[model samples]
Target: MSDRWQEMAVFVRVAESGSLSRAAREMELSQPSISRIINSLETRLGITLLLRTTRSVSLTDAGTVYLDRARNLLAEMEEAEQAARGVDSLHGVIRLAMPVVYGTRAVIPALATFMGRNPDLRVEIIITDARQNLIVDGVDVAIRLGVGQLDDSTFGARKLAVVERMVVAAPEYLLKHGTPTTPGELASHDCIIQQGAFGRESWRFVRNKTVTSVRVSARLWTNSGAGVTAAALAGLGIALATPLMAEDELRSGRLVRLLEPYQLPPAEVWAVFPAGPKPSAKVRAIVDHLAMSLGEKT
Candidate 1:
């Protein structure tokens, strides 16, 4: 800061010591040099810092406020320095954003374990489905789904997991309309659209190296994965979703996975960050933990 930090350090020492001679001795500088730094700092700030007398020095009101704030800033800077120097490096707040259902069901639990290992670290979590501007939001990192979503993203990413998805329908709906044996048969059935989860109108399946897309009628449309599971549970229509989104229902037999012979392409999850400076040690460490933890569990 053009030596402003040095000036503040000198001012803090002089204010605490209450004498130019003592401050100079503590810093190994001449008393006249210490006096000049304090004078320049007060002049540049346009505020009187110390009430100087022949034998004693005391703070003015403005000086008292500045001292409190300066101490806090200096302490934070020291902590940042320690982390950068790799002395207990995971020592700062990391703002992370992710899709709601996936984050709650998958990421947050794993994040809790990561936090346990690095107790000095703090995290602020943002749950959302919208694509966010990392710089604007001050997001240090983000967890995102789908390869297509990341194609135009300015952030860089590393793959975390490939989530398998399948078509599902409530037992009541399947009972009403006979179950389809092939992907082509979905053309006649109404499907619930998790608006952005899999994309619009068309659903694709891959079988024995052959890929096929089928356009189905949308019976309901929602922007959330949880909503898709809700509608499917209500016997509304068939839906495309990962097992995590409807884990309870799937396990309880309320929803049944369909199209056993074919498979929907897996959704790719990534740890994405802004396009500048390499990710810090804490960020990289958490990503590594997530890759291993989330991969094995979900």
Candidate 2:
């Protein structure tokens, strides 16, 4: 039999690149050699692992199952090699996904320090509010806000931060309209509401451990957190926003918190990744760095 490790590596590369030619180019091997390795592996295992077409190649059912195990095995092998070389020397690309707001303000800043420490590693960060399917997107890890509702049976998660929601309004707006002391009084005020990935028209508040729900009518509605913050700062109306997003304004007194007695639900930020016997050194390093940075901020 041929080298099982070499065959497994080729299989993984093909699975990741989605085309034999691309995988061959990535692995620095000829197309025929890549094809021969995969075919030999499939023949030896008595399984057709991939479905190929002119346009694309996809994993068969067995291929999907085998792919997951193969990935874990490769990861373990890489870790073992790294261990032999000393864990500190290991390096590779780490693909990460994060919400746009947090990615810009928080994650990016923290990454500078991480990069300084790990010069051999490269990070590719995708910033968007939409949750990505990690395996399908080929993301190594993702920073997700709120409770991770994604189905992650084969993944692990680490809580990075907890963001408390606050009712905020521009100083000028509050000066003109007056601040509401109670949740009920918000009915009389113009509220800039958000309708996005989290939810629409559902605002929750808590007082003395008793929670209440409110459906505040929006004078201006937006799906972007940055947009909502901008509107509120321009004296449009009151906005319910997370402290992380409004920290600068709140500190500068550009925005003032209102209805302090009633509490909004705190969203938890988590670092999520595929479950494996041993996580890549780069993944663990980034996750740990984020958790530490966020924890300190919190």
Assess each prediction's global lDDT (C-alpha) against the native.
Answer: 0.80, 0.80
Candidate 1, which ten residues in sequence have the lowest lDDT sum? 273-282
Please tell me which predicted candidate would have the highest TM-score against the true structure.
2
Best by lDDT: 2
The residue pairs found clashing in candidate 2 are none
Give the TM-score comparing model 1 with the true structure, all chains together.
Answer: 0.70
lDDT of 1 by residue, 126-153 (tens): 8987776664455767898873566535
Q: Which stretches of candidate 1 lie over 4 Å from their true place?
A: 2-89, 147-149, 275-277
**What residue runs in model 2 are displaced by over 4 Å at the alpha carbon?**
1-3, 13-46, 52-57, 147-154, 171-178, 187-190, 193-197, 218-221, 276-278
Worst 10 residues of 2 by lDDT: 194-203
> Number of backbone collisions per candidate, in order?
0, 0
